[model samples]
Target: MGKSGSAGPLMTLDINRFNGVPLHLQISEALRKAVSNGQLQGGERLPSTRSLAGDWSVSRNTVLQVFETLISEGYLEARVGDGTYVKRQVLGDFTATSATDERPLETKASYPFRGLSQRGKALIAHRLGGLTERPTLFMPDVPDLQAFPIRSWLRLMNEVSGRLKGDILVNVSNAGYEPLRDAIAQHLRTARGMMVESRQVIITTGSQQSLDLLARLLVDRGDPVWLEEPGYVGARAALMANGCSVLPIPTDEEGINIDLGRSKFPTPRMVLVSPSRHYPLGGTLSAERREELLDLSRTTGAWILEDDYDCEFRYRGQPFAALQSVDRDGRVVSIGTFSKTLLPSFRLGFVVVPIDLADDFAKARAVIDRHAPIMEQMVLAEFMHRGLYSAHIRRMRSLYAERQAAMLQLLDETLSYTPPEFECAGGMHFVLPFKEGVDDTAVAHELWKDRIVSRPLSMYFSGRRKCSGLLLGFAAFRAEDILAAGKHLAGLGDLIRRND
Candidate 1:
């Protein structure tokens, strides 16, 4: 038993011997709490280590260790000839109270500062949907993960890792790995028919980051930006987050209505479009409309943002060349991602900017994230160099085509009513239109209960005249899985057509 010092009695600690917690940690926590709660006052001397050890029934080394920890943390200070004392400044403005006083401290209920800024709140409010680590059946825009060539990818990764030296490791480019940029540029020239150089390609994390960067650099706040109505929710979110006034331009079989957009919001700062294949609806922009859109952009001095996403998955005739291929002036900015082609987790994408704006985009990229992961970029470059990426794309095209055919057949045989405007040539998903009175959102929620994932087409529309439908994806699932899910969907045909 240790005697009380001149400072008064040491506070009693309820140390549980039966518990799994170590004795030293419990003792240290007790002392820390005592100091924090004003039980131990500043400049007050503590019991000697030996006396404390005896009183606490712990080893002397444990007590010494605890004292050293507290001293390092500025809770206590050690003197040469004197005992350890609480630091004088540790209890600033706190009244010294007896350990026996067990009254709880009072605190204010509310804070003066607001939680989130208006921009932050708006950014979160525009979220389209939640993402899952493991995608379920019929989830739109998800690639088949199980079919990815992991062995070849691993081999390339190992090769890149082995070749890494001090110079290569330290001297990474701010824009991206040079070889990867070159590979991407070359691929775009041949595949998408875009006349791009490595310098014009600014690599980004994915399409989302590319959109965010372009919005920040190209347009000012409250500027008019036209987007396809019943369009991609992500594009809307990105534009709205940057304080752009998003104008919903309706689309038909020929893509965004250029004449309609001109009549309503003629002087838009930027126009975002998926001309190769319209999202959800899957309509390729007609050649006439494409020319008209470009001419309009030139007249209005507006920038055109072409989202060439999933253009590689076209299962029908030859896919149309990228809109950037026909750009006479330096206006169209093209962006694409590998998430739909390769893996979503890789987050590899690129933006093709005009030659004059390339340096500015690179500088902006440097400020944003420096670059994508260096090793992954190097690996991807090598993968493309060996023609593995092309091969993988070819294999996926065949696989997805088969899956899509199976899904269409299953839907035709299963459903009682005819699917409206269900002619999709090549894309990940197609919209199954419901009657005007039918609630697509309620039907989608009901499908979720049966473990069948589908995006409500109404959620994609920001305008008051929303379309009632469901977007069903066929690319990510196998034929058998599609068949299994289709049976469950068949049972809901009556519910889907009830309003009709």
Candidate 2:
């Protein structure tokens, strides 16, 4: 009863221009659906490509490509003289009545195998806080990507790329590029006051990988590991992923409570601390606590992981010498990353292990990823060797200090109350504590809706006593943007009032 060839059925395609799908693919899919649904009957001829293009407001070539694709897929056939037609074989036993009458078989969705392992589930449970790939306003620990020295970096990259030859390409070191290790060791000796040797330094993808590698290599499964309370979530995730039992040790203005940890979780296999400047809180570990921590490690035979992230960005006075610098024994494994000082995407970080563990760590590094990219290492080595890396750090320190000052001034003028911790000497972010009854997570969620990114302080805690607050980052934001976002933040005045 239908016409042998018709364009009427193809006209109601419901093409969407705003859904980000390609026009040709959309047209092809619509045609296939029409044939499958029996809306277009078997052996029904389609309109000419030009006619379809004009009707759909698409190019003639788009329609032609769509026809060719469907023909190849056997959904449609093309004749020399006649126009395109739906393949009758494709509709075998698929009559117009059957297409409408036959329903899809009723079946529940089922997976082929068992679900994730317990370790996988634990890793998911301890996952780090949400962070957008592209940095947003007030996103903590993100550096100013726009301010990176791309010109100098690209020049170094070009220089390195040109030098890549037989041995450079084929004979990669398991430890890392040697010159880069030399540069890092030299920098640590001068800048961080750590007496590290190039042979002891092993390059990793980043600090996250460094933590994971150390966790798996240093500790056995179910070994107790002491972590700073309200500590780095990534560290917690890494340790838990390796089946380590995380023991949260409370911290104060001075740093991790050494006495409290010894009294409670006494026999930890390892102790991880951000001693240079405690993350989020900006508290420097006291000299006494550092000694105590080292003593604790010595007596207990536990390894100490010093996460010296963002140590180079200290705004005022000198940061304390690295914990590794004071380690009498080689029990301290210091991890450093360019993610904070340089670009996070560089994926370059290193660990200064004890002399005995260097070869073992290098072997593990080889097993994991066979070392970081060669060209990047060469470029970074050149950059550091030329003193450009230190120069960049100095520039970023001044810029971040100005931004921090601007943010503090904004908060002071806007908010009803300001916490004492807001006057921190250095660090990328400041924690704004909320009253006991206030839900910091809910407040953070509401701020996100207003295009202001913040991490709820409660999310950082693995222990029972969780503090409710928000970590507001200023390092990556310009003064004007910080002011603009601060206005929105000020609107939540009562919501962020201090508990005291």
Candidate 1: where are CA atoms >4 Å away?
A: 1-27, 30-109, 129-134, 416-422, 495-500
Query: Residues 136-192, candidate 2, lDDT per residue (tens digit)?
Result: 888888899988999999999988898999788988789999999999999999999
Q: After superposition, how far is residue 138 of candidate 1 from its true place, in Å?
A: 1.1
For all candidates in order, the CA lDDT equals 0.85, 0.85
- All models, RMSD in angstroms: 11.1, 10.7
lDDT of 2: 0.85
Across 1-500, the per-residue lDDT of candidate 1 in tens digits comes to 54443333455888999999988889888888788777778888888887787787888899999999888877889987677988877633333456655666644545557476766776787664553334787788889999999999998898899879888887777778899999999999999899999999988999999999999999999999999987888888888888999999999888999999999988999999999989878888999999999998899999999997989998877789999999999899999899999987878898999999999998998899889988889999999988999999999999999998888877777874443442457888867777687788787777777787888888889999998888888888999889877767886565453324
**Runs off by more than 4 Å, candidate 2:** 1-109, 128-133, 419-423, 497-500
In each prediction, how many residue pairs overlap at the backbone (N, C-alpha, C within less than 3 A)? 0, 0
> CA shift at 328, candidate 1, in angstroms?
0.7
TM-score of every model?
Answer: 0.79, 0.79
